[model samples]
Target: MADCVCVVSEFRAGNFRRVSFEVASEGRRVADALGLPLYGIAVGSGVSDKAEELGFYGVDKVFVADDAALEHYVAETYVPVMAEIIQGLNPAAILLPASVDGKDLSARLAARLQAGLAQDCTEVVCENGVLKAKRPIFAGKCLAWCEWSQGALPMISCRPNVMDCKAADASRKAAVEKVDAAVPEARSRALSVDLDTSGKVELTEAEIIVSGGRGMKGPENFTILEELARELGAAVGASRAAVDAGWRPHSDQVGQTGKVVNPNLYIAVGISGAIQHLAGMGSSKFIVAVNKDPEAPIFSKADFGVVEDLFNFVPVFTEEVRVLKSTC
Candidate 1:
């Protein structure tokens, strides 16, 4: 068995997400379980100070690979460095986020290292010296548990927003190691990263999500849902119908092909909640649905149900929430 676990950290516009912190905590937990030292790999042009935070999260060593060529994400640039580090240190496992960029890098690294990879994992743990990971498959219709057959370092890509950020000590220290890194210039590179501009909160991080569907009638009528979302400080999501109709962007679609979001509260207005759609948000903590159809599939999962037309109902709901937030 290898004696270390490495977590790959990403820097976007010089800031890290909670996903990185969560991965560090998870790596620490796995390390402790298997009697291995936890290590962190932070890649960027000059991210030395950020490496210090990894120490607070229980990392025994922080590997910093800084190169002027590493300034942007070129798969060719990062995968080689990650592969080199894993081969040199021979860590038992490595963890990265299942975010857009993360899947790309993790999959590439796994193949280059000829290692086993469990993608979009909800859980990973070492049991009796076996590294086991759990992930939903078949669009959440089934679950799979993975353990490497040959004991290759298990490369894992955990879904963002699924793991909670562990508390930090903020006083711990890590041995920092720097290696010679080269950026292999790619023939093709990112033309642009165009994120759909949104006045609504980011769906992945939002505590509340308000989603609408065909029942909302048309694109112009989405204002009702938008107003309700604004009042609740919730993100606006859409069913496949709304997205397909061009009423909302595909990024705002929450389903098997879209984003999987587990929020504190999910409010579905006029959504039918297909199994595929439910798979995405089924893990949410609480649900409230408003549909004129009492027998709608969405109602089966709702903690509260209102059988009424959302157009006639939202004004009252918005007023109540506004008053409640004001009082608090």
Candidate 2:
């Protein structure tokens, strides 16, 4: 039985997602520790070009499943193909991103293989020839360590932004394997994918984020936050309150009830930090809170705070950012 570490390479718009690279790098480390090779699997239509890119991140070999039916992410189609790959490879461990698609695929595959699964892991460690995973529990207030039983295959889904993304090296080389896997007839098919055309960085992948809340008054006022975000080349986010009030879309909401975000810089504009909101973004490297209330809960967790009306402060802040960008 092969004991190599396997990573599933996820792609978006024909390019590798940042999390895919992160998992590849992390999987390399695990493979090295186990004295085994690192393998990558890419699934999609016309994914050969992208599959080759995994070599730059330290993959020794790649298995490419390029088929028209695999173009879009439908669990019904993906799970069966992936199951076949795992059964043949029988890897010691499998790593995937904890994204929406990743979660669905990993869970189904685990059930199929009867493997041990560790979800949303922040750290993966090796001890005495076994894999141990560190994951956040109770809304990130505590960490839990988990390990698979002896000789059991471990399936892990890592949270985004938890590990540092390693730089790609063009000098690295890998052997590409064209795998002709079986695709079963599916009851459902994804005819098309309507992408987010906001022209801004995706929230989970953005290094910098600018967010608004109920204090922004209405949806029209969110334009100022958008302007500031554009100046910083950052993503725009909204608090759950703003989303619940119909001032913003659910996709833009950041909180325990919504999408969790970890960024280098998070600027909260007029947001009163609720526990739920902090649970999502409390892991950011730096936090800046702007609100009129001096005793706002958000200020307690912020590295910097400003007690001023957002209407008066946001315009000036956006102008200063514009001036700063012009100079740089």
Candidate 3:
């Protein structure tokens, strides 16, 4: 009896995250293939006004949960509303961004709905009316293909940057419906939140990344990399060695044991390119590695390699990038 494909939209500062558009674009493809309408579900206090924007990316209709209790992201509050909407619409598949909150929300929703859940999916397709997902497993060592039966509702969390976001069509519009979500008293409430004021783009969503490793000498030297990143409008990343040495936070670490990033351009400064590190960003569209050691393994994978002392090269590189940006 399923008739639609649904997307769970994630928003911050009243703006939809990049993954929202990405998932909606993917959801559009699936809906078209199955001959069903694509719907978007937005949950947050005073978020009804923003739900219609999903239409720009391809959603035909949108469901909104606008309640004070839903102002902040609480799994306890979000799961119930999402479950109610899914049960009402009987969507064949639900797509979510594989963010920290999205991962948590999708898992709990799958359990509550007794549906099959697919996590970290890179690709999604509909074959003969069944939802099939392609996901990376074993820390990107291999990919596994999975399918859901027509009788089962499937919840899928898509990895960031894996799916392309379609350009917004300003002329498109979506019909919105306000859902009455029964939210119970929360056992815990978020009293406050701390914001990252660094102004750097989020690593998972960034199209360009500039990273440093142990060769930068120490934590203080990361300033040069930050300058370069700012000039390039890219995110700053770090290798495990830099993190272990207390030079960078674990949140900035990128590798097999950390976060996986597939940006359009990846610049590795002083990183020796261990197998674990390569496993994380090897899929980058273009790689530029700078290291004084000529035999460093990173060069083998880099589209452009430079052998020079980072201390000497990075400052000059940052200045040149700044100049280039000003000229443009």
Candidate 4:
């Protein structure tokens, strides 16, 4: 019989990702509801020392898989070791972040274990000792609640910034157990990686975001948005139109076909708010839209709206933010 709830914690650059704590907190809730223990799985090179951090978020035990071969995330190498650890625990439900790597890991693990999997979940709830996940469907037009079949293990990937991460209890500690990384020879391996050195927070994890669309006229105009974003300590994003026009890289695109974000504040400058764009960021806590056209669909969904040319308004907004930050 299945017993504990397991959360797969993700780390990068020797630090735990914020979503790791979010999922651990959610896993704690599920574990408590089911009257079971909460376990965390951490796999990476020299990561055993960091496994204890998950305890602050509520994990009762952590399984660490440390190996030089596991430094970089290769689906083939990670899936097998993770599967081995998970099978030993026989967890009732498994939680992972919906990050690029996490999503890949969860999908492969689900297939390997033949478990029921839910992806990009915005909410997870416990009902009658079972876990149900709420996720967007039909281009974010609706939400669907998903549950695993009677005998299948429930594996869920949660969207970042949507779930609340509680304050850590410094006194809490989890029992850490080391497991052999014993990875299989990969069919293919990454020879090298080009890391993002932009020094900006990732869009999916940013608390605030400033996004531009075709109305910005060209890529050069993004400097105005960048200035404001810097003052706000936010990330810069672009609509699909801007990306398609080559004004920004595809990494900055936010839409149904792009990355979904759930930031606390989303500022849309000159964006007309296509359904695809709304599908990605409509779950934001607060939305502010600035567009020259009053009839832009973005205004309908924005908590605050401004009708003005982005060229004229953005500069003034940037200056105001600068002044506010300077005074603070």
Q: Pick the candidate with the highest lDDT.
A: 4
TM-score of 4: 0.97
Q: After superposition, how far is residue 268 of candidate 4 from its true place, in Å?
A: 0.6
lDDT score at residue 328, model 3, on the 0-100 scale: 91
Candidate 2, residue 105: Cα displacement in angstroms equals: 0.9
**Residue 216 miss distance in model 3 (angstroms):** 1.0
Ranking by lDDT: 4, 3, 2, 1
Model 2 scores a TM of 0.95
Q: 1-328, model 4: which lDDT tens digit per residue?
A: 7779999999776888999999999889889999999999999887888889899999999999988788888999999999999989989899999998999999999999888899999999888877789999888899999987788789999999988897999789889999975899999887767889979889999999999999999999999999989989999999999999999999999989888999999999989999999998999999999999999999989999999998899889889988887898
Q: Distance (Å) between predicted and true CA of 40, model 2?
A: 0.6
The local lDDT score (0 to 100) that residue 210 gets in candidate 3 is 96
Tens digits of lDDT, candidate 1, 75-128? 988999878877877888889988777889999999999888899898887888
Task: Indicate which candidate wins on TM-score.
Answer: 4
Residue 212 displacement in candidate 1 (angstroms): 1.6
Candidate 3: deviation at residue 249, Å? 2.6
Q: Please identify model 4 stretches exceeding 4 Å from their true place.
A: none
**TM values, all candidates:** 0.92, 0.95, 0.93, 0.97
Better lDDT candidate (2, 3): 3
lDDT tens readout by residue for model 3, 1-328: 7789999999776788888999999999988998999999999877888889999999999999888788789888889888898889888788999887898998999999998999979999777777789988776668899887658788899988879888999789888999888987878888766768877688888999999999988999999999899888899999999999999999899998777888999999999999899878887889999999999999999999999999999899888888888899
Q: Which stretches of candidate 3 lie over 4 Å from their true place?
A: none
lDDT, residue 175, candidate 4: 92
**Residue 165 in candidate 1, Cα distance off native in Å:** 1.8
lDDT score for candidate 4 against the true structure: 0.92
**CA shift of 144, model 1, Å:** 1.7
RMSD to true structure for each model, in Å: 2.1, 1.5, 1.9, 1.2
